[model samples]
Target: MASHRRPTHSGLTHSARVTVLSAAAATAVAALGATPAGADPQTSPERARAAVDRLFQEAEKATERFNSASERATHLREELGQVQDGVARGQERINRLREALGSLAGAQYRSGGVDPTLSLLLSSDPDTFLAQAEMLNMVTERQHSALQDLQRAQRSIGQLRTEAARDLSDLERSRAAVARHKRTVERKLAQAQRLLNSLPSEERGAFDRASRSGRGVLPAVSGDAPASSRAAAAIRAARSAVGRPYVWGANGPSGFDCSGLVQWSYAQAGVGLPRTSQAQRYAGRQVPLSEARPGDLVTYRNDASHIGMYMGNGQVVHAPYPGASVRYDPVRMMPISAVTRV
Candidate 1:
């Protein structure tokens, strides 16, 4: 401290460093002050419409998935019931055979408790009993036949129970899938509703009016017969439900999903089709788009989640979406996947 020692060669003391940092901080503060205040945060109408459209499309896809899973669950439940019923009948048949075998054993015991017939009846292994009976001629032909029937019944019961278990498992999985789709659809619809609500009041009213207008009127139906009798009948049936509501997972007289509409219409025509749009796409012969007739099934998008009945003049009658009725629209509304002549 007493010495007049020169500063370090670098010549940057602590005070100088602090001065430089202060200058930098001031510059940053000025830059921050230059930014605009009160910038607009609201979404534009066009942007909002696009977002809503996307959400509705997503909801429709999920609705189709829900419908398909619900249908599969129904079919699986019926099959499980049938298999379980078969198992029950087989068990009853086995009980009858056991009773018959017991009666035979009691009759043999009255004569002599050590007879071959009684021994065969008491054998624990059905296969071994049959084998021994064959080699030793220990049982009558009728008894041999009875043992074969018992073995058959046991095998049938085992197979049926196995099948029923599999169906039950499949049904559970389908139910889960249905529930998941339902949640997806609900989330999408809620988002869409929020977007719609965010719109200006006048725009919201316009949207509501546009959605409801001309919805009750049925489009003109083609009078000519379809490519086939079944197709014609299906088209007629679909025409009958043109004004019905679009209800997800419904396949009936009141309302329908896209694939449900096709499935229900085809069922009315005495032709059974698969429940999902993707499955229904391959349920019949594929026809060229130009060759599509009034009754053909029109699938849309690459995934084929949406379907409709072809009405002549380039129109398709379909359960369009959640808010839309079963209305007629141009076939070119979306990209076509296939035209199935169902």
Candidate 2:
């Protein structure tokens, strides 16, 4: 944040909110993977402290992976630039050598130029003849050496040019891989930042208490989905707020993930619900697809991970992913398993 921000008792600063969020998200992910039940784990402050420490450990691991990816991208970019420069310089040297060789060959082949033997025979006196002959031989030797020098430079440049081109090709592939890795790291960091920002200062003590004991009492939303008018109004309102970014687990004016947005919409209609889709599925009355109506809880995917509200005409207003805008998409595209009218 650019405004007033302070460090927490855990030695975490608000400006590093992304790191904190990443830690919390990592905790949620691991729990989803290995936790047997979503039970209350908090018993004491000491225990909560231990839990937060564990969460922080998870955060560190995720951060390490992100940094590693970023470093790889930087390395690839640097290597590419170096190799490209080498290729260009080698090409320039090769052209210059070729040009010099062409001029020297033309001079050696010209009809106006005489052979060493002919030049010696054309001299007027014996002394002059011997001297001119020796000079002619030296000139011939010099021309031969110059042509050889040009050939050697051409050969050296050709070999270097080949190596440089190969290096450049390798660098291009590495750069593409690095770019993919960079996108992953940036997305993870941004998601973590969003979660930390969602958990404001007021919740810190409570979060700390929960973390000490490996428990967190996620605040429930306020509203009811079964109330038709209010629920319909809420859903319509949510639809109007489309085109916002899909920040995972977000519920809001700015953006939200699938479940978070649905939960928030119902909350506006006076329904109270948990934050996760798995919990959301169990919050409302189960209804068959044939009986499903607008403002009903619609869940998809095996883990009940994705949720959306049933809009009329068989569409859903939901957040899709990290880099997407929340909008209405076909409900049929989702892996729907059940429906609930809250």
Best candidate, lDDT: 1
Q: How high is the CA lDDT of each candidate model?
A: 0.74, 0.57
Point to the candidate with the largest TM-score: 1
Give me candidate 2's TM-score against the actual structure.
0.39
Model 2 CA deviation exceeding 4 Å by range: 1-31, 38-99, 112-128, 187-342
Q: How many backbone clashes does candidate 2 have?
A: 14
- Model 1 pairs whose backbones collide: none
> Tens digits of per-residue lDDT for model 1 on 1-342?
000011222344545433433333233223333212432223233344445566777887898788788888989999998998999999999999988877766766786767776787999999998897885564566567778888988998999989988999999999999999999999988877766665545555555554444355666656655888888789889888887887877887899988889999989999989888999999989999988888998898899878888888778888876665777777777889999987
lDDT by residue (259-290, candidate 2, tens digit) is 66876777777877766677788887898876
